[model samples]
Target chain A: MSTHARPRIGEQHCQECLVSIGPERIREEFPTLWTKVHGKPLVYLDNAATTQKPRSVIEALTRYYTEENSNVHRGVHLLSQVATQAYESGRTKVRQFVNAAHDREIIFTRGTTEGINLVAQTYGRRALRAGDEVLISAMEHHSNIVPWQMICEEKGAALKVIPMNDAGELLLEEYRRLLTDRTKLVAVTHVSNALGTVNPIQDVIALAHGRGIPVLVDGAQAVSHMPVDVRELDCDFYAFSGHKLFGPTGIGILYGKAYLLEAMPPYQGGGDMISAVTFEKTIYNTLPYKFEAGTPHIAGVIGLAAAIEYVERVGRNQIAAYEADLLAYGTEILTAVPGLRLIGTARDKAGVLSFVLDGIHAHDVGTILDLEGVAVRAGHHCAMPVMKRFGLPATARASLAFYNTRADLDALAKGLHKVREVFA
Target chain B: MSDLRELYQQVILDHYKRPRNFKKLDGATRQAEGNNPLCGDQITVYLHMDGDLIRDISFEGAGCAISQSAASLMTTVLKGKTKAEAGALFEKFHEMVTGGENAVDPMELGKLAVFCGVKEFPVRVKCASLPWHTMRAALEGQNGSVSTE
Candidate 1:
């Protein structure tokens, strides 16, 4: 309700300080020289999709490829041994990052899509029976929804969706009503990608557990934006991508309770997944590696470890606070535009702001913003069910991260004005 | 204003505000529903055919300006054309959208030429071509349901 405060202009400080952040300092501190060379000051607000790589993550990637490049978990050569140590150490770091109960529970995956598919193929194939139900929310991204659909189709399991209210908050009463004896698993996003609604995941998990239903929290959107401790939440399974969390692509983390992970079938079959293989007989390895069959993304895993370390140094609490403030700032400035409608207004929300201007198509808005050197995602955001629920075709989404500033929102505001002028 | 004018030509906005042949054809002989699931754009193309000629054409749907206007323009152009001619027009329009050379002159396309700018926006080309694709499907005797999910 406070009047929009003008952000401090042209300040420089260490990554620790709030008051001394400047463009030049950020460019010098981060490895964004390639972006800077293009004669554009990029204002990236699509963090819900993926975060920009910092200098440390890029350097770590380079260091792994140049200095420690070798196949891991095999051979007695020194390079192979160092690579194996770094890769395994990266696994330990991931376990700590999400506070998984054991390192054995952290299975390296090819980002969130593969992580969920691994669960669906392994656990869903074994545990789910015909007439049993997998309850997912209406706000799930395509990655979360389609995998469950495939599993349900194969197993004759019914997929039930938990609906949301107009404010983009999940209808708790409806969810409770939908949870019957047939409910086998409840897979939900920790944060809604389209609506920015930070779901009450702890309560959701507790309720499902009370009913003897396991829950998988898709932390693809939540992990980077907030502090996530899987042990405290007591979720049976959690999945998130490294790219979304400022790490390299082709790497993700799937956290499951050690017992459940050990019980599930191997997702893929190849070299590292087996203790020994013969023409007639084969023995499977232990947890984590049972699901990870092929040679993993070693450099990507090391880079993810570096990214997690960077996040810890910055502190999740500080990052969350900064992002929250930016979200509020962005929301105020954006909603001030005449005839501008903010689509998602959940009481508990993340930094995503999906909205529509009365007379402008979201694509047009996105195109104009791109020309102005501001990037935001526009469309159903892979959550077509959410758009259908609100009777909207598409909405422009400006999702923030720790790196975004109030000036970015100001540029967005200016861009919206241009949209209005063009449409008018 | 002039730069924005390039993207949204006056004719395009005019068709969007008051689309031609923008009505349902009850008991229509050929009908198809086209959907761009990415944006939730839906259009139902209705054609009342007399032998091989499209005696009447109309559409009813909800979508962004580009899609709605494209549908309106498609209906207007195909209303009196034969099924074969309409199919050829569809091919030409498809080529124009996907950046292939087409024989249809820009000026001859009338208000439909307003979509020429859509070629530049690779993402929105789907929006501008949804109705034409649906109409082609209907003329080919396919059921009235197609979705770009």
Candidate 2:
């Protein structure tokens, strides 16, 4: 096991504390944001889908291939050792990023989907029995819902849902009622990708803990928006994708508690997971390496560490404050549009502004918005149940990041006006 | 906004707002449902056949302006055509929207020519072609539904 790390520099000495970083400076960091679409300046509002990578992160990926390109954890050569230290440094960064208990608790996987699937197949398959239930909220992304369903079906266990209100906020009362003795696990999202509702996961964990049930948080949408202390949340398993955090794709972290990960079996069989291999028998490796099989995404891990460093330098609190204001301004501008109804109106929300305009399909709105060089997501958003709850097939979602300015929102409003004009 | 104007022509917008035959057919001889899961678009084509000819054609579904308008225009043109004629027309329409080589003349398509703009927007080709696929399925006695994955 390696050392559990802290942020590279203390928060008090951070540059954001001394001087406020405006959106203009932040925008310059992301090269893609400067490009034009359809002969118009791009207004990227699809942060929920995936964020634009900063120059630092892009450079990090390129640097790894150009400078230190070697397989990790196996080589005794100098280049291999350098690459191994960098890869392990990435793990330590992720450990500190989520504020997990140990470096070994952070297992790098493909993305959030794989992270949840790991827990579902290993922990869920082990704990669940013939009559057991795996409780999840209605607002969960398909990644969180499907894995448990697969495990439940195989184990002859039932999959249950905790209902939510029209506001897109989960019903704590219903959740309490549903948390029965037979529920083996509780999985929920920290922030809804489609709805943007910031669930009270602290209280959710407490409620589940009251009944001695462990909670797993789908933090894919939360990690970039706000400060996520897995220790503070007391969640047993926390999963998130690096791409959504402005990192490289195909890399993500699953931070499981030391005890829980130690008890759970390896999800996949291959090279790194085993301590010794023979025809007769084999012993599994330590905590995280036990779960990580095959050649891991070393470059992705290095890129993810660079992304973490970039975000930390920008300051999480500043990002949260900036985006909160953007969300409020966006809500005000969109609500004023006639025949437009906001889908997720949770009092506590983050990043997303999902809506539907009357007499215009979401695809049409997305098309019109694209014509104006404003990018957004217009589909089920992989949250079909949430769409059904709102009685909509799809919604046009404009998700915000710290780099977005009020001018971007103005462009969105202008594009929406164009949609109305065209449809009218 | 020249491209936008060509894509969302007044005819398409009008049909989208007040689609013709946007209801379930009562005495339809054959029907098939089509779904574009990417955009959550669903369409059901209902055909009333009289021996070899399609006596009536209708569609009931919800989708983008291109899809709904394309279906509405399809119902109007194929009213009394034979299944073979409709199939040929569908092929021409498909070629027009996909910008195929040796594309059918726009004048030959008449009101259906409005969908020519769909060629510029490749992602929406499925939307324009979904109802036609469903209509083909209905004519061929395909059971259950079709998905434009």
Candidate 3:
């Protein structure tokens, strides 16, 4: 604790509020944003793919491997115990962050991809029968789509999609109609990683629940942008990755309902996930351990905990508000560009701006922008369905974060002008 | 830098704007579609092969300037060349774009020399070589699409 760590009355939203003493200030804590590319300041607007880590999270990772490096669980040594405590602390942080009912419900997997696969393999493998349907929306990332597809294919079940409008919003009536007794599961994204469409998960969950169906919400793009209380959302399962939230990669959380997790079989059977094993018989461990099969990514988990702390300290509400303002500013400027067409114009959106310019390919736009030291992602964004729906080969996406300012958006607009000039 | 300017030379831009042989060949003996799925660069190579000689060549697709121009320039140079000669030229051109600048003379490449500067950008090497790979695939009488991963 430092003398300047405490937040004053109105300062509760910026930098420090809950910390007893000196917590690092929000943007100042991140040093990567100040990096220079090709003699220009790096204006990184590609936060959707992955986020830059803060000093605290980086330090936590280094501290873990440097000081308390040991295997977790079933160790009597001090280093192992400390490592185990740190790892379990990370799980507790996730449980609190998502407000899951039980700590045992928080399972740490590799990332969102593995988390989705874990659920799809364990729950979906058992739940889905032949001719059953797994309902999903049109705007889901490949992660949410492929896992269910794999399980459905294996189980002889069909994968059904709830189509979206041209504005990129999911049709609730279509979703409702798609929900049938044979619909084993509903998987939808809390936010579209490609379009930034914030889905109505509450209504989605309620509708699915009325039919006694479980819904899995992919919060990989939602958690960092806004506060997410899974208990409040009442989603049966929620999954998200650590790196997307400013933590290291190779770590993620899967929060499943206690009863559902208990009823489902273990995703993987290994040392940590087993109570006892023999040549003839094997008993599985408890909820969280049953899914986490191997020695987990200890440093990544610790870093994730620090990242969660960092986001909480900065205040998710403030992040949501700041990015909302950035989105509005970006939309206004980008839509006003001479020949630019904004792709995803959902009524409610955040963190993404995808568009196309007349007579210019998205890759060329990306290259020219890169020359100007602006990093924007130009591709299908792993949501090829979204691109196909919009009848575009690809799109230039400039996703924003809390660290971005009006100057960054202005630079993006200026870069578009340069792209226009280059083509002309 | 001079390298970036050279990579996007005026001639390359012109060819990109008005590609030389961007049409479906009437009597095509061989054809193959290729795509770089990452950037959505798609091209269909149509080869009018008279026995072993490529009497005419054409392409149709949408890609970045470097890819489209490289493909356009390839079609112009490969016309009337024997299949063996085309393969030999592909090797030389690939070496020029992906190899060291001093390894091959730009004057030896003629109009295709503009793409020699693409070697400065390791990522753009694929963009410059994608059409060549697809051409090689088509000359081999293959029907599958090629990908520059």
Candidate 4:
């Protein structure tokens, strides 16, 4: 309960100290991890799909619904005022979390997919002209790709993909070549969900900015694993989901630069987004409110703030170091399994291990792993382009999180052994 | 491991390892592609029919053990059966995998009974039935593609 008492994670001496406290302390906070599945202890490795919520986040949801459950923005009464204050404070927490320049730059959304679609429809629809190109990467999730595709198709713009190497790292040289005068916007993922390749987003942003192109980052997989500073990266827009960060589902944040968001049209027209209304001409609300239409997910925002606080308390630097060590151990152990070929081998990777067994389909591998109480995602992972790049129909993915330990990876290895045995 | 063993019986594994009639028909009267987008499993069924009777049936595809074995076993039982019989078989097979009430008798299913274990895994029902769905599509002259969404 006392986070301040722990040694500062980045200090040289505290690395071992955090290691000593280890995942046991962290795992205790997540109640679901302790549960059994298929008569065995659950080895939950599907973090990239969605993370397990900690007690603090769960309790935050409970607290919100039990006490401060009221509509936000328009309420003039005491409960409404309290709910509005809490909701706005959640926005401020998000601003601080991503280190956005202003609170008004943070827009509450229905997860990362909605956030990407918002910018693609509003900013992309406006800026794109005939024959213009919107550059995205090959490793992008379907969420990032499809929105741009829809907007581009509508605006008579073509979607250009920045190709990746065999190891799943983006080809920066090819990316540089793709950026040109005709390119209107750049959308890319900070970390690939399927491959776990931690993209060089700083370099990506710089290359796009050099061409005077605005960049939007899909940080759904990055926010929980590493510290993100929107100002430091200089990305014009960054979107992330709360569920992926151990918070409740149906809520996320889209951080855009103030000027860009001000210029863009509203994504949806509903109650909270309007300031003054008339049948003839209605005036829109200002800044973030202009984007967040209808009644917001008040409890999800509160829970997301709690999840952010929980992650901050654990220290992202320490979590990164711990997960890196675990990844190395995982890579070694998983490679030792005969016929297990890893799909992504990027030098700078975090949070996922996607692979395919020699003679086993990923669907079969998944069913076998589930029997051993090791949960993993097995499919194209909504990144069919990446699947086609490797000439694979599907790959079994075991994604990581800060709460996971070497023991969990060991269980995954054991499960793969069972998979091989079944196939043999 | 009882449930696992039941689901992945030796017979099913054998069929998956060496599928029978796993070839494309050169002069096929009917064909249909089946896709299970959830698992990326795809199968193309080819049939050579003569006057409402299946003279030769085969499948060419790649997928999991359940799906591959199901397709392999299906081709074995369906040869020479009438189009109406194939339709009835599809219903019975669907009911078997879904564990519906009054599930078809295992003895009646013959080799196809091995797939009865598929009922335990609801998510995989599509994998076990993809080939059958594709086969049904081929029979109906629905030539394009079918998806078990």
Candidate 5:
């Protein structure tokens, strides 16, 4: 009889665990066993949906409510002064995070949805004329598409869509052909939430600028994954959600050029966003305040600043490198599954893997995976045009973040095998 | 290992795999297309009626298991029934799928009883109800471009 040697426990470990193995080690080392004392450690593969809040961000929220809890820009007490300073400091941090030129150019709103709506109502309704064209890509989320449609309908302007290939990459040739003298604005996503394709925004912005057309890049999915320099890209408008970037919900930033913002009308009429309010007429406040209507999410803004600081401390480049490595590994393992077809395979991609099995519904696959405690997003992912172009009803998408491990990929692969078995 | 067994019960899977009257009629009176954009599920329902009675009913499209099965079961049940009866049956099925307390007519529902399991999954309820909604739109004499968000 041949005897096989038994390996010792904890002999092999991940490099990331070796580097940052303080409390996180205790969390990951015995996930199931530790759930008795600590709560269940959720294997969150739904980063594309929303990210898990880190300890620093949670602490920041608690600290702000405990220490500097007061309304900003209204009161005249010591606590109010500290609160106002903290709020301004949060704005400055946002300006630096995206490398914006001026702090006044950043406007805080409810989220990316509200930001897009603000641009549509203010800039789009005012500038676009009859027969003017507003260009958007086929892979846009409903938030990016519906706002433009609403404004175009009211302004009597035409809405044109840039076609995308099967790989989910925007057809640059078709995009160039669509750009005409009547093209007023081109709105595109910086990164696709469904396909994970990172669009080449610099080239897209330059192309739009050549035609004297402004561009709005939806950075809701891209800001947390990669470094975004608004000045370097020279996009006229950029919007992102704080919750998607490891911060709290109900807060987002819209970065716009100072000249265009000044040229546009105010989005809403309110108390704080007014220079003077008379019975006959009202004068709007300066640059960003004209767009911000009411009281904002103060705790959310402070938490977002802390999230940005955490990202900077960990280094965006290092995080991107680790994510790239994980994507490569995940692709290799997922492709090995029999009768599995990946939906989007663009060369320039993020850490998203969307696929469909030969004989199973995406919902069935999702249900089976959920039983194994591995969460993933299924269905069109709010991109119906992309699904129509690809001849698919729905797809299962597995999006990865920097905190994901190779073990997570293995678990996903194992769950996929069970899906195949169920459908075989 | 059959998808019909795991997701759908035996009756619904059988109806989906070999659907009854699953073809376009020579002269269809009422036709409508229903879409569920959230899942990219689309179906075009055709009804050939004589007076108030449904002579033949059919559907043609590609969708998920729940949708296809629901379409198949709906066409089978409505083929020989009157338009009023079909509309009443639609209400019953809708009630059952949406978890309402209204009593379901089991004979009218037939194989569609398997789809009652979908009520537990809120997202799949739209898939199962697409065919009924499309039929309602066609009977109301509307143009065939109905969407369930």
Candidate 6:
């Protein structure tokens, strides 16, 4: 078997001269997004949970399983080499996607949850001394909070919370006050998954940097909706999941600064992450390889790269603009319904509308909406603290993607009326 | 589908709207809180036990129509029955709502006949039985809140 030229992603699958995607193209490409639920055209507004995959991403996974099904970076055969190249290209794509300085900084994990746990167990456990504090926001998802709690608990370090105001925006003044000599690390979400508040991460990072404290930004909710530049933010660490970005589940990116990753211990000990294994003393692999233990999700990486490419082709600016319109439209229409109360009204928010109907539980609203083929999440949204902050049990949330339309919001509005009718 | 209709029948809605015995029992012999973590629904069952017979009962909580109404109906049926009878009723009701192969007759359930629609929705079975489970916990004297994970 001969080593061929560089990994090309099989050009026939993706034409190089492809046009940038718009909302129209998104509708046409995502056949599942337009599926009929209960004989009604599916109006999916649960994008925050997971974005629907484009045709390219699905095909990428299909092609990988069909042709390039082999272990990466080990075998001398052509298939293994091709798979390794594709996987490496995935890392490069992730690096560029987040504007990281180097591909070596990227580590693959299960998703946002595992990424946080990785940092918590490795960097957090190693760096934090007793009486030290790890500060997080009130609006953070449980994934962002629980891992820190677990690590802080084990390390005998305290977990401090940055409270938010009624609008669901983190109180920066309070955050400034919370900062002290003992504040070892600050973990904040780039955009709140529950409240949809886009945090002032740059300002947060600068403040932490002043105190000589490193910050970890949870970018799971923000990456799909906006452009992220780790170099621009100068954050020590950033993490995001692939499923939320229209790729397969069980794959995510954890992009840390190289120096920090070097100092931290490897997350897990397993194969592909070892330079040499010995009974007495085993040496870990360098940079990324050290962090990426075991056989990685080869197909997932390729699919994620495809998803990132699809996002790139769609033009982040175009997607952002379209989603903004949808958000405005959704807010206005959802607000018009009688007795409806919007939960999070932060000035800076992503494409999420969380609300409650008077005298009706969110679960009831969700059940009624499901009959009409409108999918919206009605629960604490894995952000129990956010729900607690608002003094609510749960809220009905409709989060948007570029593919979602004003008509979908209308379906939601119509469905809410049925909810009211049932109670009335 | 008519499943929604069956799940939210007028009787269930009426019970939800104006629940029977939905006041805090100030002097309760036993009590247990039931919480559905998924929906953030909470129900507390208060049993005033007099020997084997439940002399009086009341409840107070907030939840979906199915859960609240089921709790209300539970409080009503459990008033005159002995502890053993309530336990039997709970078992029969559980089987009816979960659509067990040993399903009870709808006529046997009476007002609970409306809950026959709940059998179709496996997820909501917890909603319908949260109060019954809480009452069982209250009787058995569990330490803390009962959660339907």
Model 3 chain B poorest ten-residue lDDT run: B1-10
Return the clash pairs for model 6, or none. none
Candidate 3 has what TM-score? 0.95
- Cα lDDT tens digits, model 4, A27-136, are 87789999999899999999999999988888888888988899998889988998999899999999998899899999999999999999999999899999999999
How many Å off is the CA of A64 in candidate 4? 1.0
Worst 10 residues of 1 chain B by lDDT: B1-10
Question: Which regions of candidate 5 deviate over 4 angstroms?
Answer: A1-42, A177-180, B1-7, B27-32, B48-55, B77-92, B102-111, B135-149
Q: lDDT by residue for model 5 over A3-66, one digit each (tens)?
A: 2243211223222332253334423322332232112234557788887666567778888899
Candidate 6 lDDT, A115-170, residue by residue in tens: 89999999998988889999999988999999999988888999999998999888
User: Each predicted complex: what DockQ?
Assistant: 0.47, 0.88, 0.64, 0.85, 0.36, 0.75
Give the poorly placed runs of model 2, Cα more than 4 Å off: A1-13, A17-19
Single-chain TM-score of chain A, each candidate: 0.94, 0.96, 0.95, 0.96, 0.91, 0.95
Displacement of residue B31 (Cα, Å) in model 6 is 1.7
Using DockQ, rank the candidates from best to worst.
2, 4, 6, 3, 1, 5
Which model is ahead, 2 or 3, in terms of DockQ?
2
Native-to-model Cα distance after best TM-score fit, residue B137 in candidate 2, in Å: 0.6
Candidate 6 has a DockQ of: 0.75
Cα displacement (Å) at residue A89, model 6: 0.6
lDDT of each: 0.85, 0.92, 0.89, 0.92, 0.82, 0.89
* TM-score of the second chain in candidate 4: 0.97
**Which regions in candidate 6 have their CA more than 4 angstroms from the true location?**
A1-24
Write out fnat for all predictions, comma-separated. 0.46, 0.86, 0.57, 0.82, 0.46, 0.79
When summed lDDT is taken over every stretch of 10 residues in candidate 5 chain B, the lowest stretch is B1-10
List, residue by residue over B20-94, the lDDT tens digit for candidate 4. 999998788999999998888889999999989999999999989999999999999999999999998899999
Off by over 4 Å in 3: A1-25, B1-3, B100-102
